[model samples]
Target: MDNLTHSLVGAVLGQAGLKRRTGLAMPALIIGANLPDIDAACFFWLEGAEHLGFRRGITHGPPALVLLPLVLAGLLWGWDRWQAKRGTRPKDRLPVHFGWLYALGFLGALSHPLLDWLNVYGIRFFEPFSSAWSYGDTLFIIDVWLWALLGLTLWASLRSEKKGGKWRRPAWIGIAVGLAYIGANWAISAGIKASSHSPYGLQADLIPSPPPLEFWKRDVIYRDPETGRWMMIDYSPGSAIPDAVPVAQGQPCAIPDLSALRKEDGELDAFLFWSRAPFATRAQGGGIVLHDARFYDPRARDRFSIALPDTPCEEPAGE
Candidate 1:
């Protein structure tokens, strides 16, 4: 999920009455919500596909979830103390409770992985302990419907707060609605998978790719196990599963020999690690390129693919 969604969830949690728990409760919740993303700094040193393997690894795992909030709580606590010593602390600020701050931080940090797991881009929940990737495949990375629900509830909650009416109700209701919406999408995805049969008569792996703005419409990626062919189909809420179009149709391509290529390098290892539906092809310069079928754009292969050396050059003819 995007940072905006995470921040909104944190803000919503605060508006749901967690803000009154401590002086820095809101900050603890909001900042801790996005804290797991600290690994984003890896982009400074890791180039290209390197980030694929490193971005959602250990920082999103159990160990970091426990420790990162402590770091955040300590920093927030120190800042609060420093402000008091300088006599710059707001008189209206609630009393600082270190325990509450820690709890809020932990709660906020926990939301990161939960929301991230709801998207197609997998997260390593057991990293350092295990390098396994988990996917919710429930919601799009950015869902407009989710934004609307959170945004409307947040606005209503703020207005209620100003009037001293019931602010917590709106946020709590929004949380319930969000959970139901997620459940509906999960059910829809499962139904589609169950109803879909492979056109090639091979065992098929179906991946639901949600589109922006429209929550009901889905584009599914289907991989044929026997032939290693990729296909795609668009799905709507009430519509039946339609025939899939081959991803390689009319595209000039060749299947590179996977056994011939060296696969020990950092780039190759990273690509393999993150790609859920990987395939190989011949580059224009006679080099080998690897691609994930989910991001397989005939016009933009280079964007989601990596080039490898032309060493074991057994170039089969274009398919």
Candidate 2:
């Protein structure tokens, strides 16, 4: 999930009565919600697909989940103390409770992984302990419907707060609606996968990808077991599966030879780690071009693919 979603979720949690638990509780929640993304710093040093291997790893794992919130809680606690000593603390601010701050931080930080797990990009929940990727395939990374629900509820909650009306109900309702929406999408994804049948009667894998701004629609990717070919179909909830066609380069060409490719520098290692339904082909000039079936688009090859150099110019190897 995107940072905005995480922030809104944190704000929603705050509005649901957690904000009054302590001073700076809102900050603790909001900041901790996005804290796991600290791994994004890998972009500075990791180039190309290398960042994929590191982005949703250690920081999103159990150790970091425990430690990052502690760090955030300490910083927020220290800042609150410093403000008190300087007499710059707002008179209206609630009393600072270190325990509440830590609890909020923990709640916020825990929310990050839960939301991230609801997307197709997947996450390594057990990273450092285990590198296995888990996918919810429930919602798009950027869900407009979610934004609308959270945003409207947040607005209503804030308005109610100013009027001293019942505010917690709206936030609580928003959280419930969000969870229900996610559950509906998860069921939809499962249904689509179950209904999918391989064109050639070979074993196939079904991956349901959420389209931007369209919560009810999904793009399903089907991989051919024999040739590594990918077929795409647009799916709608409660509707029949549409005809699937070859995407990007059409039928799977040939599997490129990667036997000679070096893994010491972590290029292939990273690509393989990040790719869910990976396939290989020959580059225009030479070497191997690796891609994930989910992002296979004719118009956008460079966006989700990596090129490996120094391979023999031989025909693609048989599966």
Candidate 3:
């Protein structure tokens, strides 16, 4: 999920009454919700696809989940002490409680992974211990519908609070509606995957590829078992009809024999590690182009794909 969604979720959690738990409850909640994404800082040091392998790993994993909130709680506590010493603490501020701060931090941090899992970009829930990726395949990376719903809820709740009216009600209702929307999408994804039939008797993996505002449509990645060719199809759960043509490149691409390149090139290795459904096609320079089936788009050729122009190309193992 995008940072905006994460921040909105944090604010909603705060408005939903967690803000009453401590002096900086809202700050802790909001910041903690986005803390996991701190791993993105690797961008400065890591190059190319390396960040892909590093991101959403240790940071979103079990150890980081526990440690990050503790660190946040300590910082919040330290800030309160500093404020007290300076005699600049707000008179109306609630007493700062480390226990409640930690609790709010935990809750907020937990929300990050849950929302991240709802998208096609997978999350590593138990990294360091296990580098496995998990996906929800329920929503697009950025959902305009969610932004609108969450943004409106936050606005309405804040307005109600300022006017001395019922504020928590709106926040709670917003959370409920968000959950229902996610549940519906999850059911749809699972149902489509279940009912989808591959004429070649292969399993289809459905990825939610709805436009920013729409959620009824999706795309699928599946392999032709007989030919070992991977293909993608735009599909709608309601219609259950598979498109006759594969998306992007009309013909399916083959999985290259990556054994030699995987061992020699660190960049390609990282890309392969991060790619969930990787495929390779011959490039114009006689090199191979690597892509993840879930995100490949012909219009955006440079994105979601890496080119290895110097390496000697090998025939695809499937060939």
Q: How close is candidate 3 to the true structure, as a TM-score?
A: 0.92
Candidate 2 residue 66 C-alpha distance from true site, Å: 0.5
* TM-score pick, better of 1 and 2: 2
- Candidate 3 on 172-250: residue-level lDDT in tens? 9999999999999888777656763544233654444454556877666666454555556666655656653444363
Per-residue lDDT tens digits of candidate 1, residues 57-122?
Answer: 899998999999999999999999999999999999999988999899999999999999887788
Off by over 4 Å in 2: 196-204, 238-240, 250-253, 256-262, 300-303, 312-319
Q: Extract clashing residue pairs from model 3.
A: none
TM-score of each: 0.91, 0.92, 0.92
Identify the runs in model 1 with alpha carbons over 4 angstroms from their true place: 196-204, 248-264, 301-303, 309-319
lDDT of 3 at 58: 90
The backbone clash count of each candidate, in order, is: 0, 0, 0
Candidate-wise lDDT, in order: 0.80, 0.81, 0.81
Candidate 3 residues lying further than 4 Å off, grouped into runs, are: 196-208, 240-242, 250-254, 299-303, 311-319
